[model samples]
Target: MKKILPAILLALLFILTASSVGYAADIQMKVDGVTILAEVKPEMKNNRMMVPLRVISENVGANVHWSGTEVALTKNDRKIVLTLNSDKAVFNGKTVLLDAKPYLKDNRLFVPLRFLAQSFGCTVNYSHTTVSVDTKPFYIDGVQVAAVQEEIQMTMGSIVDELQGHAYIETMYNLLMQNKGNEVEAPARISLNVHNRLPGDYDQVVQIDFVGENGDSITSFGLYAEVPSEGEDEGEPKVVIYAETEKRWYAFSSKASQEIWELNAIAGKNGFLTMISNTTP
Candidate 1:
């Protein structure tokens, strides 16, 4: 009777745990080391782990759109289309099969997490109640990008900003990648002994730092708009890009400079923080 009683208690505990696994609010999703506080938590269906599709995909820098019940995810030149209640998904122009069908629960679309991670060149690991996703870093000229920084000199004082998240960081990187400038010689340094200089000569409009996991800046590029130059566009006051790692300078493309200034215009509006949802541990 004693052995039978112990077995019955164990079975009861197993039943309780099994019932909760299907839908539990304690489940968490972490991207690039930051916990995501989502309105609808993770769930298990047909023995597969399901996650909120838009919440997970957008955080990884993908653009998600929907047409009726069909959803399309675009990122890094790759596209994926998923239909509700269908196991088929179009991946990069190729139709493929998903492990489970997508469904709506509590007004949120849920899909298998594995398919979303792999399609975006990310690594995923599921353990206990948490799903961790690590995305690939941005790179330019064979150099890895770490973070984006901005500084503006206003009449009152100086305004500084540090940017985070894929929207800001990735957008900046893509802009730079699209606009490659002409290589040029480095500019002169600021010194009181100099005969004559302008405020623009002594200050950089903004700078971006590429940092690694060690917290050390691998490389930093500064955008100089007021520096004196012998180039043809002297009167126009062209922007200059100085690469610290290479110790070289490049003429900032005119179009790119315009976009950068536009980006600078809003750097201090509310600080350059990105879309951060409720965060869990």
Candidate 2:
């Protein structure tokens, strides 16, 4: 009787496990409006959602590292550490308890969804078996800017004249425009330093500061370029631009103005100093 009972219990457990596995495939996960097609879908454990660690982390711009049974995630100034099968995690060097611990499943590290989302400074929403994660805000010198899907395009001449008084901007602009095709090369990512207080125009005005890849201070500005898509033979090449701020990095292009120039200025006692001055002749 004991042997028969044990066999029946093992069979029932296998059936339950198989059912849960099937349900895991049905759970949907979205990050910042993009759907995540994880190799191993998320599953529920004790009513908590657990997701694949690397898949979600990289998607949200977090760096992931693994050492033995420990996993570490670093994003911006925050760091998170989690150990296998342990309900404890270290967030930014502070130990915190987890509702559902991380574990290894199907050769992938699965972590608690809510804990991971909150740790990365993202907001989480769960409904109807779908999990949505909105990444933390991008900041610039403590001020929050509205997220835009397009990038601003400025020519070398316009950027140089607008930042005429600034030595750093002048030097960088000269270096960037030295070569004939330099502007067409990869545009340098830059941060802005805005001075003065102006209502409703804060987002448009900023002093440009460019930093080179080697951490050396350089000057450059982003411009739009159109590149042909793969397998495309004719038609217009898609325009793209790469622009970065202190808080966020954007790779976008505007459809309205492919080669348009607009004048910008700052109100001063004497008159107005040109901010976004002239364009290419």
Candidate 3:
């Protein structure tokens, strides 16, 4: 009877393990309205849903690092640290107990989806077979400038002009030169706004606006500069600018272009101010 009892317990454990696998296979996840097709699918543990760490973190623009049995996630100002098979997690230096501890499944680290999403300021909803996550957009605020500088011609008909203050000014000067016949029109204005979302992984928005002579806006364009957080080596950041007139988006990683665009944005604002001053009574 003792031997038979041992065999019955072993058979029950096998059945439970098979059921867990089947349940995990049916789980799906969606982030920001986009379905995540992770190489390792999500799993269920202790009535909680566990998702692949890399798949979810990358989708939500979080930086993830793994050391031995510990995983670290950083998004903006918040940081989360989780250890394998541990129900305790450190969030921004505060220890919090997790409903379901992270574990390794199929050689991948699976973390509790609801806990992670909420920690990153995202809302999570679960249905029969799907988990949906939504995060609010970041707020943006900034300042602008507009000014003009005189052009100087060097010896032997060589045109040399000092760029005065910022490259944005030079950008504005070029815009004015392109519309030489329309000097009465308000010059293009430049602006720089910071995206306040993820603390360590924020972005800067640079904009250029062209205004009509009657104070109406003509056209507007801008670029987004993605900045990485401290202690992170995210290679080179990216800049994505959309040209409304052309109906196209341009993305690059050239530092020179980024600096020129930033300076030009400031200069553009200054130039517009100058134009207004000249036309005022």
Candidate 4:
């Protein structure tokens, strides 16, 4: 009887864990400083919050253009075209590889909001309770900018319900000089931190700083990336990076370095950093 009782308890625990795999998500709209609730649906295949693209674009006053597998967005006369199934994206007449590809699911085209927002001029914000999408005169630390990307985990289930699911948020960022500005590279200071209520599996926080020449500083920016540690199904990395660039940070296994060593090393000597985080173990 005692052995049978223990086995039953174990089975019950497993069932409880499996059942906690999905939760409700909250959606919001942000114009200026006011935020209101928006519609939300479950993207079953990807487990993402399926938001209405039309509502989002219209609320922000962005003109949307679609042609077969391609979607083009025009705002303030600036244009960005994304083609389905293609890794390359066209922005302002320049061709570049998209960090995240656009896709069509259930008759709806879904693209990463960060890409559209930043390429145009917009910003996205996420908190425990709300996701604020703002598009009017937004700036970071006093710099008037549109669209920046930082990584945050979109909860599959309601936080109040405490559901456990497996998913990851990885982002990529690129900085290009404006119109023959300079071909120089610069040393940059970069740092990443993950914020989560539960202990994250890959709790490793790495920072890198580097130096750059005068022209290099103009092209310097940081990419913040996070990934779930292997074997930890419930863990997710919530990352933030502090540097000069448009936001959208990506997740990767490599350590973070100031002025990004791998990238700068390829471009040769152009930039440098003076001080960095000096925390000892």
- Candidate lDDT scores, in order, read 0.70, 0.54, 0.58, 0.42
**lDDT-sorted candidate list, best first:** 1, 3, 2, 4
Q: Which stretches of candidate 3 lie over 4 Å from their true place?
A: 1-21, 138-252, 255-281
Report the C-alpha lDDT of model 2 over 191-276, residue by residue, as the tens digit.
Answer: 23223322222122223344332434333334433333346573533333233332323333333222122111211111112333
lDDT of 2 at 119: 76
Error of 2 at 18 (Å): 7.4
lDDT of 3 by residue, 1-281 (tens): 99999999999999998987777788887765556656677777778888888766755556788898888999768999999999999999999999998988778888999899899888899887888777644211222222232222222222212222222233443443232221121212222233333433324343455433243434444445556566778766655555546565555344644455455343333222222212112
Question: How does candidate 1 score on lDDT?
Answer: 0.70
- TM-score for all models, in order of appearance: 0.61, 0.47, 0.47, 0.38
Model 3 accuracy (lDDT, Cα): 0.58
Q: Note the residue pairs that clash in candidate 1.
A: none
Of the pair 2 and 3, which is ahead by lDDT?
Answer: 3
Lowest-sum lDDT 10-residue window in model 1? 272-281
Candidate 1 per-residue lDDT over residues 90-194, each given as its tens digit: 998899999999999888899988888888888899888888878887655555655565555443444555665444467676666566578976666632223
Query: In terms of TM-score, how similar is model 3 to the real structure?
Result: 0.47
Clashes, model 3: 17
Candidate achieving higher TM-score, 2 or 4 = 2
Over 4 Å off in model 4, which ranges?
1-21, 27-51, 138-281
Best by lDDT: 1
Model 2 spans with C-alpha error above 4 angstroms: 1-21, 139-281
